[model samples]
Target: MPSNAPASADNWWCDESSEYAFMGFSYEVTACQSPQQLQQDFADIRNTFNGRYIRMYGACDNDGFYDDVVNAAWDNGIGVHALIWFGFDGGNQWQQRRDSLVSTLYSNPKAKFVTRGIQFGSEPLFDGVLSPNDLASQIWDLKGQVKSLGIPVTVSELAYGYQSNGGAQNVLDAQDYLNIHMLPFFDATASTSNDAWPIVQNNLQFFQENGGGKKMYFDENGWPSVTSEGVQANSGAAVADVTNEAGYYQLLEDHCSDLKNNAQGGIGWFAHIYSDSQEPGYGIYDTNGNKKFNFAPRTYC
Candidate 1:
């Protein structure tokens, strides 16, 4: 929590709150949930895990929700990073929404700690929503605008499968910080499989080589429930998922250890809850907010 703490113990990237905290869900932001309810939920989560940060995705039209969540986080001593979802139109509507949100924070300096810089776009490469070059341009422009307001910025959820050259290169060049979500399950194995280790290692190496001096954060990385889709159908078929929760925990511990020792920046996991709707289950906690069967891991470093 202390700003001067060592990066491994509790600095911006490798802090205790970020390394051990979970990214909160965004589905709870629908119109159904009132602002007050959202605040209460934020409080509950803070008390439940003593979380220091919460990741939230924001729609261009949902400025009110953004304001509510930002204020709630500030009141509760929780850091809120808003993922700004932009459409293809490239209109002022999205810009206006962003401006308003940033303006709100600037107007209320007390809430500065509650809100972090905007996440330009999520997984733009995978979604095919924006070309790498165009994405870079947009990110640069957005960062410039936010910086004009004195807000630091980062690109959230960059697709790791893409090579770390060209447009991806441009995005890193354009921003003050770069963030990547390393979902190892996309590799041959979800976690237990040997493929997982190298996949992460290679990605870390690439980021360090290309990210320049800019900080890189592992915004999202975790294993999901094993399913048939997760398995590889190669000459020798291998299980796609690691059913052993302890293996998953150990994988994280080892991975974090390596990340702490190697990566110039920091690393953090995905959600507290893993969803079965997706191929590989990706929740650390069940639907009811309870730690899943094999979710326990030693927190002391």
Candidate 2:
């Protein structure tokens, strides 16, 4: 059977299969030429995806631009599930940026139409840029600010590397919501061992056991078909072709299964910047907005 073949209702990631639901795609707006243009693009996306929720981030520190994007999403009836207010290029002024973001959202009810959750920082622990307690405290403070504003908050970190060293525990202790970014790249050596699933499982288990009963979310997860350095082995040798796309789908299905009951939400790959040669093949839609693969065709049971 074809790998892209539609999975049945019995499939673990299927809408009827479990409680954990997958949020469609997390969009990046950096590629748009102008804020208005970006807003228009988002409007089209919202129409195309209809009921699915989309996660999005702003390009510059322009509140107006962010507001426009959010407004566009809302106008089209699209849900702007999560607002990644800070840390696009690893710049860590989370508190300041988040304050600005919250202020902007509150000032405009249209912007607030689609958002309540905020992603504080991305990959702080992996880069050894922020200490565990410090990161946790940041999350705590952000949550407090959002709650004081009468809205809920969520904190997301880079996957694999960021929370590798007790950072997960700290995040759990400090924040009620946890976000994980997951990317599955094929490695000849690692792929055989089913390394990806184990890592995801362990992280979920750790979070559940450590912090108070906070919810976990696979905030960002995807498989990339092309790499900057080209296809290579675990030892960095050139490989034949991009690993099977079917394998990618299978991995997603399995990961969704593991997160079925526990995960709060999920977001699939993405649909922008389809031409980044370095990270090619990651887009679910092509540069012209063609569907690369229908990973999830059904949204609900």
C-alpha lDDT values of all predictions: 0.55, 0.52
Candidate 2, residues 4-92, lDDT tens digits: the string is: 22222123122312224444556665553365665565665555544345666434565466677666665655655455454435565
Q: Write the per-residue lDDT of candidate 1 for residues 1-301, one digit (tens) a residue.
A: 3332122212233333334323443322324346786677678657765555666543535546666776677666677666666544555455566677666665554445565556776565655656778777887777676664445677765445347334377777776666677655555444354446776776667767877855555565555555454333332333434364334446666666555553333544444232332223554554455455544333334
Model 1 worst lDDT window (10 residues): 2-11
Pairs with backbone N, CA or C atoms under 3 Å apart (clashes), candidate 2:
23-266, 126-162
- The number of the candidate with the highest lDDT is 1
TM-score of each: 0.73, 0.72
